[model samples]
Target: MTREAPRKRILLLTDIPPCSNLTAGIVTAQMCRFLPKDELAIFCVMNPHLRPMLCDDLAGIEMKTVRKPTELQRRVLRGIRVGRAGAAAIEAMKRIALPRRLIRQAIAYGRAVGATDLWAILQGQTMVRIAAPVARGLGVPLRVHVWDPLRWWLDAHGVDPVNRRLDLALFDRTLQQAASCAAASIPMARHYEETYGVPSTAVIASIDPALAQAPPPKLISDDSVVIGMVGQFYASEEWAQLVTALKIAKWRVGERKVVLMTFGHERPPNDVPDEHLRFMGWMDQPEVIRTLAEHCDIAYCPYPFAERMAEVSRLSFPSKVPTYLAAGRPILFHGPSYSAPYAYLNERGAAYLCRDLYPSAVYNGLAHLIEDSTLYEATALAARGAFLADFTLPRMERAVRRFLGYEGGKAGQAHGLEVV
Candidate 1:
């Protein structure tokens, strides 16, 4: 008798994808790119209100659009909506009601597509209704990926005491229900285990290898120094802090320049007077890397004072950390000493860390790197080495596949195949 082919069906449920400005959307896109295309079938569900834009962008994947609510669903949705002000109320209600319905729909959709396994990516309180029952009812293992716990808590409707605690109760129940869970970083994983009493084995998060193998750094002119920072600008004060540091760097380096490169929806203020500062907005990944490698001399990873709380700080590991490492340059990190990237930097001897967001501190750090040729080369080389050893896409793929028990050749022997 012939052996059957391996089952390759998977259903990924998420809120944002190709059309949104959120980090979740970017991470979801990266996940799709990392998985073996021939071995995986992706089914995505996004906010119904964004269907038009998302439909066009998600052309290659199988997708279903879910609207905010119809007249009837709205009535049930309204009771669950959280927050007294803004659209948070409507969004809160939708989170509680939508996930349960979406999971049921996902089961039917997966069955129709001959899927043997189901994977649900839970954003926040939605985990309670979406992931729990599907794992129990379908007898298929479920994985929950958490990025921002605080954001989830605040944004989730009906989870708090004022909302009758229905959502919070359900959210906790899903933790016990899921077969496995994944977080964006080790810190996040720890948070999940501590707060929800989930097993450590259930959490997994990694950086893609493709991102690390960015084209080798290109040489630029020596007359001006370019300091680059990427990702969305959520806090304007943080941007101003960066700009202030850049201005201080300019004063020290004389003619050296600084530039802000953004990859999302946020735009820089038009009235900023720094000639050294230039904003390149919303570039694709390849373009973002190319621009950084060719023009940037230093990569700045600055965090403002507002992001210091343990609840917020412990749950997030900036995606840009690996991207900056892959750039083959010296990194200037302005954040807490206990941050994950700081730990990595200290381990590898690859970066400069600053406790405060002072201009003088920023200037001194960059000056040390620029002035000492030996230190500059050593730092860059160490960062690149660390990227290959720990943060490469193939490295991450192996870890994920092993965690999922998807990495055997015939019977039990694991074939160490290269990740494409």
Candidate 2:
């Protein structure tokens, strides 16, 4: 009797535990889920510690948690302490020797599991240097996943310009060595092609429709309109502007409160009084969806319109937009025209987009959404339709598999492949 062919194995190196509801983690887990299970085996490696609230979906997949500095790394440090290595040598030992040691570990793990491919999924520059050596040593294809413009992001967040420049140079060199690179969006792919001259395949971060059911539609008879936002509250200037607009909206509506409901890492600013804002810090996916459906009439997407932010807007789509759409609500987006969300929503007439980037523009947009019921309903329908048609898990799965060089029947191709 003929023996069946063994499935190809792929080792995915990522930031944290897969499907931990973190943006990149969710995409990574979904990619693994969608790959042809009969043809490929997925193994994942995450550093430090895994999330306690890890997703229970990935059964039978091998997961390894790497504590920084393996046994070899510790031995090298011990040798340095014992005068066998000098102070200058310590930096090289930690930087060079440590990754090589980890590479050996990765090779052993890959061999044990019969992995034929090494994928270095990078959320940022943190793992690029280490992953490069690991992929090189394995003599297998290295697929690099680029999520954002890391150099621009660091520069925007106030990293030293010189250091950012240096890091950008290093990341470029690392990317050049990859067998293939996948971008998070088409704009991101264009950005990489222009800046780094590497042709990138676009594989957007998408939501799984089957993972959780959308909450029942909440009745909207209340006097107040609650505006909901999920994810980090990064741009305080924009937040202040949004709060100011909502206050104006409240006054115009009379006896109706304009509430800002937020979830995730940061809390609403101390200045945005308790009456105007409700902060629920760090909610899981289900809770976030339930809260949005029950309390929020409109979803808020805010982007700061600075030069750095303009660059950011052009390179990547906001992760929260898909989540907001899946909740089946109209979006009140405040961003530049170049941003992927703004461009998409504006083109599709799916959001009340405020492109002018001022308090007056945002106030007018919010007022329009609150006062016009017909417009609100239409926008909400469009948003949800967009999500179902193009941004669902099944569509994302096909896009990812195609980008990764999978060949098979085109069962999901009608939804369209978005590789740029």
Candidate 3:
């Protein structure tokens, strides 16, 4: 019999909690699911005021919650956001003051739990900045997972220019200090290596195995065809273009109708007519996938196209790609050619590609997928192949294992994330 690997206690010190239905929560939950719960613990820090987004899958895992954006942080951030001429607040935010209090809490928890390793998911800048130091104090290895480019993520969240520049530098330092790191996409991995001279493994999203075993979705009821969109909108400019494109595309094709069906986002888009919009509200990830499979004839995915978003566009991969691939529909991808998702899908011929932000391009790309049966079937087959080849539970599991230095036969190494 093969000898089972020895257990290594792991502490997940993160900014995103398991309760969020967002990418961080979904991806983090997947990473934790295969590990022994008894040897693992969670320390999450996020603003406590917002309602948890609820990913029921990870609720059973034990976790200690800490509040982020303390009153001082909030006031300082508000000052920066509104450009209140609060130079002191901006300066204070830019100064990285050792993160002593946060480090103390993490160390106490890590020692108490006998944690052998610290695995951080890059989300909140403060938590990410502290990861390297805390792991050093605990005398444990550190591994970080980056689902988005840290710089762009901060920019997207409206982090002020000064803090953002400082945080990016700290992020680079942490990357150098880490033993391994995992990125969300191949382009992201390449960017890390080329720009930072740090190699990282690409571990994108995955779908439940059961979802792949089933037959393709039944035809939508009635004469209406639906396009699927999942999760929150990150690129405001790109998504606004999509809204206009969907409008320009029209809602009817002969006797049949077409609509954009979306779930997970809290509010439905107000610009679209009720006739063109079908809101499913928020559902768990699994439920969202299954429902999309059942109701959607085509799935739409988006990325930013503005010059300002160019760097972020290349490094950030959407969580929806694998989920949509597993759902077995012809994907309608709208983004720039340089984008991670577009490049991946273009290479695989997995999705109908719309490579510009223009409404006409988006309208034409989606229309081709809907109107051309031959292209639709071919794209669907390729999408499934891509999912099976790269994005699956098994693949993600192995990547996570390698990142944490927990792969069955491998031995542990020095801390500081090198990216797995």
Query: What is the number of backbone collisions in each predicted candidate, taken in the order shown?
Result: 6, 0, 12
What is the TM-score (0 to 1) of candidate 2? 0.81
Residues 1-420, candidate 2: write the lDDT tens digits.
Answer: 998544566777665556665766766666776654443443344544445346686655676656553212122344346332443344344456556666677777767666667777665444654677777767777777877767655554343444446557778887777667788777777667676666577787677675333432432656787888888665566767877765655434545677778888678773666777788888767567767876788888988687756666777777788888888788899888878777788877779998877778888888788777788888888887877876776777666776665657652432232232
Candidates 1 and 2, the one with greater TM-score: 2
Q: For residues 209-242, what per-residue lDDT tens digits would candidate 3 score against the true structure? A: 5576232433354577688888877766666877
Q: List the lowest-lDDT window of 10 residues for candidate 2.
A: 69-78
Q: Which parts of model 3 are misplaced by more than 4 Å?
A: 1-6, 53-62, 70-84, 87-98, 197-199, 213-223, 253-256, 409-420
Looking at model 1, which ten-residue stretch has the lowest summed lDDT?
68-77
After superposing candidate 1 on the true structure, give the runs of residues whose Cα lies further than 4 Å from its correct spot.
1-8, 18-23, 33-43, 48-61, 68-100, 150-169, 190-221, 246-263, 269-271, 307-309, 407-417
Cα lDDT of candidate 2 equals 0.68
| Candidate 1 residue-wise lDDT, 1-420, digit = tens | 999867766666565654434556655654555444443445455545553234243456666545433211122434655234434455556666766776787677666666655556665454445666666556666666666553444433323333435655666666666555666667766667787776533222335445553333332555666777788554345456656766545434644444444455455653455564567766755566667777787787765446434455545667777777776767877766766666667788778776565666766777776666677777777778777766765555554554344646522212233564
lDDT of each: 0.58, 0.68, 0.74
Error of 1 at 374 (Å): 3.1
| Candidate 1 backbone clash number | 6
Backbone steric clashes in candidate 2, count: 0
Q: Please give the distance, in angstroms, between residue 221's alpha carbon in candidate 1 and its true position after superposition.
A: 4.1
The C-alpha TM-scores of every prediction are: 0.77, 0.81, 0.87
